[model samples]
Target: MANRHGPCMEKKCSWCCDPVKVPANFSDEKIPLDKEGKRIWRDREEIVVPESQMETVRLKTFDCDLLDTQTGKCSDYENRPEICRNTSCVDEKSTKSVDEQHRETLEEELIPLKGKK
Candidate 1:
């Protein structure tokens, strides 16, 4: 639960290790980042066509880890994929709203699970 603008040590994924890119994680599609470290994902939006491999790839969540422990160092550091190695996250930015979002998402999901209709 690190502030998007806080120090790296202060901010970390709550679900996984630190951001670690291995050889396999690298990809030609380099993720662009803003000065504050926010990723520019707009370019791919237009390119993801319907029922294409790229479209399928788009469905895959790139969120590395939700915890601090699983980010900087790869879980499979020795055998990570190139695409994973090249993946990047907005570390410098304060995706701080995450906490709020997480809570809201969970609440929404739970409502469905509770069969409260």
Candidate 2:
């Protein structure tokens, strides 16, 4: 089975493909602020697929605008956004621990989008 980071080296798997949902605050659009002017993050739900079932399950929730469904690849891999560059599908306990730290780092990189819609 491919790690949760993504597909194995040679073969291409649709593990990270179209219709996958992401946090609404993932974009550069302005995040709504609450009454106290606190950033209101989207109520993003995490999909925790068990490592054993990663390959067998058909994910139909990928919402990434950059995915190329025809080729089963990212349209702009070289210049893909930071979030895309950092994500993986490899599933291991040790990797998960590392990924957790990495996720925190990514979250820190987010600059709240200013200006209202």
Candidate 3:
């Protein structure tokens, strides 16, 4: 992965022009979730993660496993869309800080919103 793009990383993030992480898969798309505050890029045909990449996406939970070991591009680039082709990490906040950052993402979280569980 490091050799494919000769280190596909810089000192800044492609999006928001913020100094970000290693900068992998910065091309990921922005998907909107119907459940409110959740989303992911998907093909115009199937509005969901493909079965073949289900585990891969699930394992990435918060985009941890999306990092490519070769070109640093997403392992699923060929199957990705324009949105996924433009995603980037934040510069100063953890990806998990949806509240503090108030940013949107394609990922979802399980929480007791109304204390039902």
Candidate 4:
């Protein structure tokens, strides 16, 4: 389910701009769920961009592997991965602020880059 409050108020979320890998078969009709009615987990690959290739990495991208770049929206909003559906910056109860959480998550998932010019 997409955010009930509507599209995120933040300009954009880092995760949406650079999503992690998803299963090829991901879709609303075929989402994998566990016996407890929870979505199944899949391993995610790190997104790495060498310092030399920084220019090649698009910032504020909407071209996530699973998103519709033109609209800057998830291609499969109804059946998007649980993580995508659950993360929300607008929810005040959230411990870490949106920027903080996003940065932490990106740091963990994005591989360390080498020397920069």
Best by TM-score: 2
Model 4: ten consecutive residues of lowest lDDT: 57-66
Error of 3 at 47 (Å): 29
lDDT of 2 by residue, 8-109 (tens): 223443343433434433543433344576543333233333233443332112345555768866665556554554555444455455446444433432
Worst 10 residues of 3 by lDDT: 12-21
- TM-score, predicted candidate 1 vs. hidden true structure: 0.21
Worst 10 residues of 1 by lDDT: 108-117
Q: What pairs collide in candidate 4?
A: none
lDDT of 4 by residue, 1-117 (tens): 336532442444435434443333344344445457654333232334434345554211113455565666555666665656655534456676656655554454333333431
Per-residue CA lDDT of model 1 for 1-117, tens digit only, reads: 323332223333322122222222335266434457665223221211113232222221233432224345334433434443333333335454644544432243111112111
Query: Candidate 2 clash total?
Result: 17
- True-vs-predicted CA distance for residue 17, candidate 2, Å: 3.2
Per-model lDDT:
0.32, 0.42, 0.31, 0.45
Off by over 4 Å in 1: 1-58, 61-74, 91-117
Q: Per-residue lDDT tens digits of candidate 3, residues 9-63?
A: 3421122211112222333343323235444333222122324444333211133
